[model samples]
Target: MFVHFDRPVPGWEPADGIRTLVFLANLAAQETTGDTASSTSTERLVHRLVGSTVHDVLALALIDDLPVPPGSKLSDLGYPLVPATGDDDTELVDDAEGFLLLGLPLQEDTGVVEVEFILDAGYLPIPGEVLEAEGKHVIHRLLAEAERVARVIGRNTLQTWLLHSPDEPAGTGEFADLLREYGYLPGLTEIQGFVDIQSNIATTAIGESLPQDASLRAEIIRDLCVPEALIPGLIELYRLASVEVPHGSLDAEPVEWTPRRLHQAAKRVVTTERSMLSVLLIDDSGVIGLSEVTCHPGSDPDVLEQGITIIHPRARGRGLGLLLKRELLHAVATELPAARRIYTSCASVNSAMIAVNEALGWRVLSGGSGWQKHLPTV
Candidate 1:
């Protein structure tokens, strides 16, 4: 008797229902594998993102597994059913069938779709198996909603989609097999709860200057500043970064960043209240390497996540990635002394970067390939 919608219902107070579903999905790891440590962290980060960020939320019945309230219609949840095979005589807000599908945008202009089909979990009862006809029905429902919303928002939609599942045996085993058949592969693994440890700045070699390669130098950007002078460098930096995947591989849509895209990205970050820092490597020409870190500062100390840190293939012989990371860490330590924990995710195949992070005293989670740096004190 769970209800799913495109947006929070009329009287839902900041919707604990959405939070509950996220918790349930993540709790699967603890239940199946008994890994309380990572499960706790994943859940915490998910709830934190929903609370601090302006993310779109759907699926409101996870609150307590209750039925849709009486006299409440699908339209009340921000989803209006469109008239199918009609001559324009019907309102799209008609009653829905038994199952409910939900969606929200991952980014405003980016065509990524975040989908949650509660039935897929089988906490209640799904007609068939997880990805049988019933599960596919829910997926198609979400896709339709994604297409409709894309048209209204005037953004290219659904070139990408996120299908979140608990890190349980079922998810990694049979359930994942079904998703792969549908062209939805696991893209991220959540590395959850960790103890914050004090950074040992005394032995840290952060301030060591990079080689004075007459051609290359480094700079850190704060407050979303893209100096008119460095715009070209910034563009190049993003172009190089978007290409290099976790291992020695190229991204599907590699080389997608343009100067226009850069500005659009900066505009969003500038308008938002979060903190972002970028470390750029520049030669006499333009940006050849880049690393970034971001965090949402709150009343107490906050955690920071390292963003993309990539070196152009042409510029990789000189350990530029390591240099930039050290510089980025130094910047974070100095600029955000109040930061509690810093973490970053990398592909399991990327051993080079993992080694560098390991040397920095970052703790690595076993199940997932992510490293976390804790700041027990400012």
Candidate 2:
């Protein structure tokens, strides 16, 4: 007869005459390694056999932890329980009426610490099935017993059961009803899903690049403050570069990089250079304004020439781009006297950035396309 149980008992065995099946499986592994083998071999065998059983027990324990009315079906605990089978019949025994007990290993230090229950899915009554009084009592008793078993297992516990007919309408109805009855609150459930996705993104290298400056970074915390008009030009530049390189293309000009954020990033660098006597550049209206160019104690001479830019759009036509770049280079040599190779990236499509860099004798370190995906919550 199909038998089911959901509690831990001392020296418990399955009631469906399958307890020997599990014991023999464990025995086979032990025998293969030789009973007289080293301690490690025996330990490995024991862990493999027991670790699996523990998971089943923990699954049940989790179900038992759910807050539900006493007469609820096993499925009403937010997860379904399924039957377990083994080869041995003699060791299996029907216990506490409809309950069947299965053997689980305990660490030596903690005697018989955990018991795993394998329920008979066929015998377990479903919600709205008009379970007899006896069947209801048995389920409640086993659930109560499961709580004690969980405590014995230790602070962390897990239980797992397989559903034989998950796709069947009967099983689906029971499963869905159970989840609704005992699942985490709606808000909490949504939060858990968000945490799962966000945690992974937070680990990427790009995500780690928070502005180094704390105070100035607050100004451009959101993308809306960025100049929306410049976005079209930026996107076109990105698209042209993609065509030229066919690969590594920028997916789209980032909508997140606001002018305030850029200012904050620049400010961080400026603050660092201030103590070390470095140069800063602000280009606007086709004119390059030298914000700072100075020499400081023990400052490297090569960095001074690297801090310069040509204003975009307006600076495109006049040869003023080359003139501004050359002037900055000269100022680095005569003023700060400490600078190194300049570095910058331009869209492969932006001949202007490329020309200015070339005129200043800057070599292209690397160039590639980049892409980005914007995710919106539904």
Candidate 3:
């Protein structure tokens, strides 16, 4: 039995939120050791973003007749009812199995639906064949809802994308296998790498001097707030960077980072209390190179994920990429005293950025693959 809602389950409470945080933390620990954060930190985060309208969130829950206490596991709940007709008058069940959430950022028109499955992985009473059938049914219901929303939002097409661990790879893990069985084709293979900056800070000192005629100055933006005046420059620099090494997408398409879209993203990061540290290299012509890293509050506060490092085409051949990265590393070490390690991912074909990361002493962490399914337009 599955119930889909536009928001969190109607009767969801604080206890359920805590249970969810615990479940997710445990999952993160399994994927990467020592990556889990304290409950206190996570609780603060849940309170902040639980009601956010920044994304169109859809949740699928399993429900049954039993009355369960708050924070109980999904498997412990009674069996679910058959899929509903997905109308406004759908009955709200009394108790629900934990849910799987899918969200699409309202700010970005990319039409990529991000997945966040919050259900427990414990076994159920159904036979393997029956369970598989139930899983397919869940996927279909979710896709149908996603497509409806896309149509309402005026999108001609959309995709559902998720990342799986290296061990799972493509066509192997349970979820991956399920998606493949349901027509979600595998996409990009990304290589993840990490470095313990405490011991490897010296590695960032590449000793590459900037070109004498470049006249560029590098500065750190600790507050994640980009001044209104610099937005144009940042956009230009990002555009040039994308042309050289485009941002990764399921279809390997380029992104047009408009001012409004960039501002919206920056606001979201700031509101979430996540650190978006950037080092921008500016010359008289404006921003020519940029490097960024982000760390989400309550989720391995010490682990910063590398965002992007880009240098204008004209700025290339002058070691600007290394210069910008080194500056960014210094900023991270100074502002984030708790920072211990930084992780970054590069597409299997992105040799330039991979070389930059390797030059900074980053070792391979794991491999991840993106899987996407294109939804048919009605």
TM-score of each: 0.60, 0.26, 0.71
C-alpha lDDT values of all predictions: 0.49, 0.31, 0.58
Sort by lDDT, best first: 3, 1, 2
Q: Which ranges in model 1 have alpha carbons more than 4 Å from their true place? A: 1-13, 22-73, 76-112, 116-200, 204-206, 212-216, 246-252, 297-300, 366-378
Q: Evaluate model 1: give its TM-score.
A: 0.60
Collision pairs in model 1: 41-192, 41-193, 42-192
1 versus 3: better TM-score goes to: 3
Per-model root-mean-square deviation over C-alphas:
10.8, 25.1, 7.3
Clash count list over all predictions: 3, 24, 3
lDDT of 1 by residue, 1-378 (tens): 233333322222333333344455545444433433323332232233332232444332322233444444454435332211112222212222222223344433234334443332544223233445654555455445544444554444233322222243223544455455554534444332322324544445554657856776777788558778888767776766655564221113454566676776676564434578888888876777788877643312455767777887767777777777777777777778776556565554667776666666656443432111111221
lDDT winner, 1 or 3? 3
Superposed Cα deviation of residue 286, candidate 3 (Å): 2.8
Looking at model 3, residue 253 earns an lDDT score of 37
Which candidate should be chosen as best, given lDDT against the real structure? 3
